[model samples]
Target: MTHAERAADFLLDEARTDWHDESLWQVRGKRDTIVHAIPEWEALRQLGSDIKDNVLSNLDTYLEQFERQATANGVTVHWAKDAAEHNRIVHSILARHRVNRIVKSKSMLTEECHLNQYLKQQGIEVIDTDLGERIIQLRKEPPSHIVMPAIHLKKEEIGQLFYEQLGTDEGASDPQYLTEAARQHLREKFLAAKAAITGVNFAVAETGGIVVCTNEGNADMGVHLAPVQIHCMGIEKVIPQAEHLGVFTRLLGRSATGQPITIYTSHHHRPKEGGEMHVVIVDNGRTEQLGREEFRNSLKCIRCGACMNTCPIYRRSGGHSYDHTIPGPIGSILSPGIDLKKHGDLAFASTLCGSCSDVCPVKIDIHDQLYKWRQMVSEEGLLPKTKTIPLAGAGTVLSHNGLYNIMGKAARVALSHAPRVLVYNGMNPWGKTRELPEVPKESFKEWYARTHKSKF
Candidate 1:
């Protein structure tokens, strides 16, 4: 099994833990109730979706318009068509300013492109300022959650890590003291850093300003404090105006953490006094994804992370299990676009629950996209060859009644001799941790033929 598949297996194992699966299912239920209480929530979702759809449809125009406006505001705009180009642009900007150390705000885009590793290779020390991201960074692990990078880790684990890395006393495990210690440590990095890099939540076309949403105010602090600010954003992040950003910001927090709104929605129209600001708009396979009608709606994502929180698979498996920067339902669909063969199994990670679609701030039909990705993956011949036989057999069996009955009889006979572990090990990802059910001695057709069919 591939890393992605292995991650899914681990998550399935986690789900088998007593009632943990039901807890996430409960979260989905609560989310629905909360959203239903707001009369205009659906409308806002529709508006956000339509706005993003419009922006994507005319992306070329909006992108150029944003460039012009941002340039007029004294911001340098750079375009990168893929991950390599994006990393090169950021590295070049850092080199031009002679920046050796930099602080970063939470940015899934950077994670998506593995920016930290790239920057480290260029000899630039990059520190993640987001609390969760910082924890994962210290651990040298990818974030397991989009909103809460270290959600899977308990506070004791964090205390231990802090004790080891920051010279804190072994017993210093209080959330308050831990937060304060992190604050003090990151503050020093922020103050001494020559440059800061942030991910853009939304870039306004009308004013050419970048909008960032954060609860901790780290993004604002990093950008405003640094002598140089570099903002990396996906091409899909552009919106028509600041007013348009309001719609997304409103829905973003509610969906992400069940908050009314994030504490700060910082808009960077200009760099601080004597500082230079640059924005790198990265394609990274997003443009090609936009042209794909079935999957294009995936681009409307606002990264609120509500879907991941509500997803049963994501909660148990955590973000790292997805083996991608952005994990869970959204990552399943997005990863294949970046690397078709290696990441193909990601598409099969979903249970088609549709809760992700329901909680999406911009209303991307994530479940549909996952289904579409599976088909696309199969069409591209990326699925494992060994599994092809059973998949093909399933298709044939389902298509013909005669074959279905014959297969049903053969399955019963096979189950009689098959070890019970084979049921646990075959066809189900859940078998990684849980025992599979025994096949019935007779099919439903067999039962009906002997009893009810006699009357007919």
Candidate 2:
């Protein structure tokens, strides 16, 4: 099924859908409260955008500088041109250490690379240490949100998941109780793990360090406790200088979850004493995205997820509906660049409300890009004939004033007089979910002309 079909299925459970909508709306509300209080929020966003623009313009220079500094600080750096290379590099590191099990913190880059499945196929066990990540890991599901991995799930669902996996009390659903149980469970994994993998929120070129922001301190625990630490970052994660960190760090948490700042913003400049640290920089179609003039601005994303929260379509449709690693407005634009044929349907998943762009901490024109992708998809002939045929006909008619006026009158007459079965039939895809509007008897032009005849 296409993304729209999957999203339609998600809407079947009204109560669950309502719960999901309210949950994200609440996050958006919190972000508004905090962002409005900050008089410099817009300025920060503009600065963050400008910094990223500069970084992208000279990405090669910044990356080389970052690698030089990181290597000097006793960190090993690996570059991957694509996902396969990224997965191979990570596995090679694991094999070099002869480690079978590893603890991992929240890293969406890993998800994009399908690192967990690849490692598991090679006989490695990867344990997600974040609370939300662990919950979804047990459920064998991808995260619905970047920051809150299992936000789609409720306490009762979590209680059942923990009961089945961690042997927690069968009826316990309290947040504190579940968190403690998970903490104890993950602690054992952390201590026993010989290596750990984490995602980099920001990689500062000037200091040759990486920043990981987490609420649970999972990244720090996993990195510090393990003998080997692997940090995965997309090439776009690099910024020019250390001072730029101040702007992004301030915007990240407040925009994502409305917190003043992340509870723990750990900067790892070097590996632990006697431990090895590896940073894998993966392009995986990022350079291709960067080369696209219209879409390159999407690279500025800090992954704060504020756009996802404010997106009405995203809240109701659910993240999984996008059928991509990262789902929502941002994902809609980025995923198509990775595989136009496979993810072409994602571009049509938005209402073009522009709310996503309005709330972006880095001012990515998400909705505008989504619209642009639609044109690109259609131009590439990726859209199904069902849409293309009708759109082509509409385009032809709309280009001719006489045909346009004739079609408008005919449409109003048919909509107003057609029988229920005829107007709301199987052929009308839109009529399945929503009723056709009550068409007025007269066209707007006809009514206007009649009303203003004396004046004219």
Candidate 3:
């Protein structure tokens, strides 16, 4: 189904949609409050963007440096060109260790690669140790948000899920109680896990280490406890220097959850005394995006999810409406780059209010990229004829001044006097959910000419 169709289905339950909208808006409000409190928030954002720009510009140099330094630090680095290769490398790592059970912590990279499903197919059991991830894992669904995987669900639903999956109290819906249940449940997985996989928030080329920020400390627990620790990072996660971390670390939490910092911001430079560490640097369409000058800036994303929280379309439509791993403004722009034919509808999902770009810590022009994606989709013949035909006709009329003036007058006259049935017909998609505006007696040009002609 198209993104619009899926979004329309989501809007069927008005109360649920309002709840989703308000929940994200509340997060956005918290972010605004925290960001405003910081005297140098904008400066920090600029610094972060500059750091990423430098990284992308010299990505190959930084990546090789990171690998060399990481290898010197006794960490193994693997490179994957695409999703299938990423999954294979991860599976091979697990297979090499004869690992049957592994625990993972809040890795969106794994979601992108569908690593869990791939390992499961190979008879390996993967447990998501993060609370939100565990909830959705039990429910057999993809995350609805980047930071909060299960944000689409309610406390009661979670209570029930815990009741069924974790055998908690049948009707307990308290956050604290449910959290305790999850902590106890995941603790077992941590203790028994043979290997642990994590997503990288930032990888420092100078330090040859990766940083993971999590409120629950699940990533720390899983990695530190496991005998084998695997860190999966997109190539774009690299930064040129260690000092650049200060800028990104400052912006990440405030932008993501309005906190000064996550509860635990763990850095891994090397493996434990007896443990083995592996880092998979996956390209997975990132290099393709990098080659596109118009959209390369999107690679600057730190996965803070600020854009998702501030996007009105995401809030009202819900993340599942996009039908991709990363949804909302960022996802809309990135998904088309990955597969324009399949995800072209995502580019048209927004109202282009530019709230996402305003909130982006890395300063990615998300709305502008969305507009550019739409044009690219059209040029690639991914757009449906229904839209292309009308747009082409409109373009022709708009290009001719006489036709434009005649159509403007005719439109105003028809809108002013036409019957409701004629104006609100099935052929007019906009009329389905919106009322036609009342036409003024004169067009703006006509009124301007009448009022200012003598002065001219």
What is each predicted model's overall lDDT from 0 to 1? 0.84, 0.93, 0.93
How many residue pairs of model 2 clash at the backbone? 0
Rank by TM-score, highest first.
3, 2, 1
Positional deviation of 223 in candidate 1, in angstroms? 1.7
Where is model 1 more than 4 Å wrong at Cα?
A: 1-5, 8-33, 409-456
lDDT by residue for model 1 (317-363), tens: 65666777888898888888878787788888778989888788888
* Residue 10 Cα positional deviation in candidate 3, in Å, after optimal superposition: 1.0
TM-score of each prediction: 0.89, 0.96, 0.96
lDDT of 2 by residue, 388-454 (tens): 8999999999899999999999888877777889977878889988976777888888999999999
Error of 3 at 14 (Å): 1.0
State the local distance difference test value for candidate 3.
0.93
User: Candidate 3 on 238-317: residue-level lDDT in tens?
Assistant: 98888888898899999999999998999999999999999999999999999999999999998989998988889999
